[model samples]
Target: MADLSTDIALDDERIVRALEEDIIFGRLAPGARLTEDSLLSRFPVTRHFVRQALVQLEQMGIVVRERNKGATVRSLDPEEVQQIYAVRELVQRQAALLIPLPAPQALVDQLLAIHKEHGEHIESGYLRGVHETNDRFHLTLFGACGNKYLVQTIELYMRYSLPVRANSMADRAALDISHSQHRLMIEMLQGRDNWVLAQLCVDHLQPSKRRYIDLVGH
Candidate 1:
């Protein structure tokens, strides 16, 4: 393969990250073809590394590979979205149930820090920062789930879902409302009531998904 970069600036991880980000942000739409040659000739990575990243995404249920049809990103429908969240909540609820409550106050503290930072971003009208910071909040909470696979799965889901969230939260007023609701979710987790925490998680998803369905539906 001809070197795609003069200085070999494109590494395997960098290429994968770039592709993943594009997919996450919906620049690469679902069902869009991803050819190895086009990418390899364009990027400096070997076919092996590209395949590896694609396989990882497949495991996370975001990318699909068909024998003859080729590989493309998954197109998630409303029912599929509901199923993903329902299963996620089930697993996370159990994870929360088992995560010794007091032992992870540090997670709550991290969410607090993220919340404070997000508030500033909100005021500045940089809505994307709020979305990223919100990821940090949930990342902290769920990262300590003690279930490595579950945590990883959730992160992958979040990456792909972010564009959906960012689009809906484009309104500053709605972003502010969302921030307040997320803050309440963090507080709810402090109680050690796994059930309530699970419900809070489900409820938190409602506002954004509702906006997406409404906005995108029309």
Candidate 2:
């Protein structure tokens, strides 16, 4: 029974991750309905597992469940986008400021490796790989702040901004800019200027926020 339970839990987690990747890579656009019947047909999981996955996604701010409307990919309005991004800027900048100057060689090396992978994904037009590696890069960079709570907050806001950031993920120019910025961030990590690093981190978020606002007509 314990083994069965573990298998079920792992199955549920797989469903959740698959759905999350769909949403992240734009296969599931904002406001696209996530009907039970469709999900049931798509994954080999039971209905209970599907429901559990939806609940988890809702909790993650990636999906919305309405009273009579069912679950759909989250769609953030311009104001909500602005507000969420404002919070993102604050927490991200704070996290950057907290990192020790002349960051540990280990952290810099890890970031450089991830940055290289990110650039390759961008060049290859692998949207999913691009998104995942880009996220890994930022999270790893902020993780060096040595404050778990701050990193957690930054991560939460990053998730919340997904809808706003989605469109840019597929834009070639945006991807190139992001790739270049990652290189700059790695270079800055080897220096002793925390403020410059902090500012760079903050600036990194602007293009997406501005692009989202403009596209949504605010």
Candidate 3:
């Protein structure tokens, strides 16, 4: 793995995001221990920042802290994965429905820009770029629901969904499909069709959920 500290600033949020990128890219594998000494060396940060990053990751359910063990990336169990996806499906579908029909041109253009960046990152195989852009794409799309609390809930569950989805950003075929879905979603917004868009949102999530469950059975 490349040294993250070289290119990026190491603040608490950036450090946590860096670790999450590492986890998603498979550089930090499931159940990998995130020791203070190890993290301190990886980034040009003090133990204070490292501890803060781990705590933030813990709250996001990407990492867990146990007595005397410090912290390790959380492993997703199949049952829990199913339940999370169930709720995620519901929330995402509802969010889709709530988006104002005839999405403003400004919002559509913003989504288009983000999706374009996602394509560029996927083509270059920049895993972290792809990850961050993907998050922005989804967050921007769902945030259009115009309910801050709903957006917050969706974002929270999206973070919790990360454990199972960690390595998915690396799959080229998966990225292709995902990007295509993003295009379809953009079209849905253009057409101002809520029901079809809602269904598409639900369908879009199934591939990753199914792929994860198949790889890691309950």
lDDT of each: 0.68, 0.89, 0.88
What TM-score does each of the candidates earn? 0.69, 0.94, 0.89
Best of the candidates, TM-score: 2
**CA shift at 112, candidate 1, in angstroms?**
1.5
Stronger candidate by TM-score (1 vs 3): 3
| lDDT of candidate 1 over 1-218, digit per residue (tens) | 67655323445457656666666555777667888877788766678777776776666556788898777877656666666666666665665565555545777777888999999988886655766787787767776667888777777767555535645555777777778977886777666676776676767667766665665455
Off by over 4 Å in 2: none
Best by lDDT: 2
Per-prediction CA RMSD (Å): 4.9, 1.6, 4.6
Shift of residue 175 alpha carbon in model 2, Å: 0.7
Q: Write the per-residue lDDT of candidate 3 for residues 1-218, one digit (tens) a residue.
A: 86766433448878988888788888888789999998888888778888888888999889999999889988887899999999899999999999998899999999999999999999999988888898899999999999888889889998899977665777899999999999999999988689999999899888889888988884
Q: Name the lDDT value of residue 38 in candidate 2.
A: 98
